[model samples]
Target: MQIKALALALLGAASMAGAQETASTAMPDDMPPPPMAAMLRPPRPDSARPPEPPRENIAAPSRAVALIAAEAALAQCARDAHEVGVAVSDAGGHLLLGMTMDGARPGRIYSGSRKNAAAVAFAMPTSAVQARLQQGDAAMAARVKPWMVVFPGAVPLMAGDRLVGAIGVSGATAQQDEVCAAAGAAAVKGRL
Candidate 1:
């Protein structure tokens, strides 16, 4: 009888220990498994992080320079007896100033803005882009965006050899517009 009691007590203790071990190791049914990539990656040390890259200092036109350019273009158009719209844009192709003469068409303002965008995008005068397109340069034509105007009405503003911005003119003949835009860009050449 004593031997049998001892055997029964040992069996009960073993079963309880087995049940506790299973309960501790088993996962809950509602819990999701860890991601494979996260589990595969080893822990990183604080000193192992990569250094940040240096930032570039981009150039752009100031508001005062943009206004001066726009006003100069409008004055040039007036002197030539042409009612026109003019737009000035920063190096980032953002419109800084836009103006139209009293007799200018409403759409001319938008045209001027598009022309400015094209000059800024090409980093040259829109006339140059037009010339390249005319020469059967399919690659250059493909680079033109829908909002860009590849007309002869825009010029890139330069400060010494660096492009700072662009000026565009509309509501007149293409040649006249180009003349006005050139005057505007030239106005701020040294100041920019």
Candidate 2:
């Protein structure tokens, strides 16, 4: 009876050892034990990851388009009896074209350039920037005003979803300037 019991105990121990080996080998060596939530949740789709090889080049507005936009904005301001200054800047905030209506103040050129630079830097309409400032973004408002004007006189240019540059108008009321700047942005819409 003792020998029979010992044989059964040895067989049981061997089976337990074999089971442990099988369980360990069933999983990859590097895979961590899955979280409880992960086991219960569905697998994530592949689309969650961004596409490989991201876009390298950025599209920018051509010089001709900037000139045309500036001219158009200037003409629009003329119709309103406003002596406005218009400016266009590249994505890097470098001036591309600037124009002033015949009776516009000389100082308007400086304001227009500042507004354009602000629009490019912020990547939004200056009116939107003003709105954000008004809505209690004091830190941003303070940080940005030294280098660029934060009024409603400029807007970022977009070629589809891409930023191309910015257009700005000055020498008029903030609203009026915004209107002119918007016109300039519109003129170059389809042409990119």
Candidate 3:
């Protein structure tokens, strides 16, 4: 009986020693590493780009050519319908030129200018878009209606697959507005 008790005590001590060894040194090899996000963070929301940049060979019309066309278009529009409002924007929707007629009402300039922006943004004629919506196809036009004028006289300025800019002319009949926009686009075609 004394031998059995000693054996049991030795067994218990062996188990205790094994448990301590496991607690002190054993590692779980199957455990997965932490997620990458938890390990490292990305750049801040407002970080500037690098100093050295590679030049891209994006062949587009010159700003001078676009301005010259815009000027001629405005001149032609003034001759035919008098000055109204003309807005011009670059391909990415940046306004490069904005003008209101000598005696135009307030907000007319913005409305007219945005009309051209709408045309370029949608890559379609505003008149056509209006006609589509008028015919109950507002599904597509609705998407761009938020940022563009549905009324006539806005035209997209395209330079091949690239859109160069847009021209919006307003302050007259829809037809007159369209004609004015058309004239401006025609003047810029050389640049496009």
Best by lDDT: 1
- Lowest summed lDDT over 10 consecutive residues: which window, candidate 1? 25-34
Indicate the residue-level lDDT of 35 in model 3: 38
Candidate 2 structure quality by residue, lDDT tens digits, 1-192: 799667666666666666565564331122344434334447768987567766345445798998889988888888888998888887766677888888788978768878877788789999988889889987767657454888899999998888898999999999999999899899989988
Give each model a TM-score. Answer: 0.68, 0.67, 0.62
lDDT of 3 at 151: 88
Candidate 3's error at 4, in angstroms? 87
Sort the predicted structures by TM-score, highest score first: 1, 2, 3
| Model 3 residue pairs with clashes | none
Q: Count the backbone clashes (under 3 Å) in each candidate.
A: 0, 0, 0
Task: Give the winner by TM-score.
Answer: 1
lDDT of 3 by residue, 62-154 (tens): 678656656766787779866577777666545667777677667766776667656765777789878877898767655663445688887
Compute the lDDT of residue 126 as modeled in candidate 2.
90
Give the poorly placed runs of model 2, Cα more than 4 Å off.
Answer: 1-59, 142-145
* RMSD from true fold, candidate 2: 22.1
* Candidate 3: segments with Cα more than 4 A from true spot: 1-61
Q: How accurate locally, in lDDT, is each candidate?
A: 0.81, 0.79, 0.67
